[model samples]
Target: MIIYKEIEISIHNSIYVATKGLNYYLDKEVRVIIGNQQESDYVDVIKYIIDYIVENKPIVSKNQNIGYYSWLLQFRLEDINYYDLYEVKTDGTEFIKGCDTAISIIREQSEICSYYKLHPQFPSFNQMVVISKGVYEGKDIEAIRYESPEHMSGWWLITDDYDDDIKSLMTVHFHHVAFNRPDILKYLALPFGYRFLIDNNVIHVSKDDI
Candidate 1:
């Protein structure tokens, strides 16, 4: 599924407009244009594009026609009182083909930021643990307990309720961490309140909060 970030719409003229954003999944720019002489209201157009994006979640290819179903837009515009508008047109030079199966639009900050931030070469770490297990390498492991300076309690525990997709994503995320930040993994089995600082080829841990 493609997630678009920082999507914005702009008007070129009374009958020409476009929407643009970065496709988070592919790390590529995406733009879609619309043309209709009778449709000049930006608000209506913006709403239509928003609904289209949320429902279709389009993904794009380098060599593909960027055409969305005209009938779908027509059906949607009817609700906004599109009584005098012409038949929608998105083809040839008017369209910028390449969107498919884009499931969401993430504006501004995101859950984990850029996909490149998750790249193995980067110096980063997961801010929080979403899932944890009670055993590691067939040995029962005690939970690591830590409290932030803000007084929020944190710990890890075994969970089996995550769906398949979540499990797969988590597996990939951990593998990425393991590849570049193996040091973090070694400390994963460490005892409670073991805060560790990670830098390039550096490791520091504090036994007490300071």
Candidate 2:
């Protein structure tokens, strides 16, 4: 059995929650930037988040940049603006050489480590509502790209038509999709304002009509 411990570290006025035992699992460590040094009460939250990620082994995609992968957390935590995650190299103790977000220690490019970054905005789910469904057949899963104000924009999976209410739609957060219908989670990282059609649980890219 593998066991891991989450530890708190401060560097350059930033507070990070990192793992001590994950190296055994992924040959690297996972570090999360909760907030600046002054933030508090994130230990338990970090522990829970890391545990969930390790246990579920959710889908991870490469970031637009090299040496990084998108490891997004499904649920939102209080006072945490960024839920996005990434992994980088480390000496197993210090931040990667020369880069001092102070996040990790640089190893050969092949080694893996984890970290987090901020997106322009995370879907607030408050102003988000599923506008329609049954837009696609055989899929039973209608996918909608949410285009709204900051913190309220991202992809929306419309599995059913729910009278267009925010409360009901909000319940369809990442967890639901990641758990019950993870086949569509691959589209989570797609850019905003792009609609996709699913046929028999398979995704195909189609040209947008001008």
Best by lDDT, which number?
2
Instruction: Tell me the lDDT of model 2 at 126.
Output: 29
Q: What is the lDDT of residue 14 in candidate 1?
A: 41
The TM-scores of all predictions, comma-separated, are: 0.22, 0.33
Clashes of each: 9, 11
Over the stretch 96-194, how does candidate 1's per-residue lDDT look in tens digits? 221221111111112123321321111112333433331222222222335532222233323233233445322223223333332234444233454
Candidates' RMSD to native:
17.9, 16.1
Among all candidates shown, the one with the greatest TM-score = 2
Residue 94 CA error for candidate 2 (Å)? 27
| Clashes by residue pair, model 1 | 57-101, 57-102, 57-103, 58-100, 58-101, 58-102, 59-100, 60-98, 66-97
Candidate 2 wrong stretches, greater than 4 Å: 1-139, 160-171, 207-210
lDDT score, candidate 2: 0.38
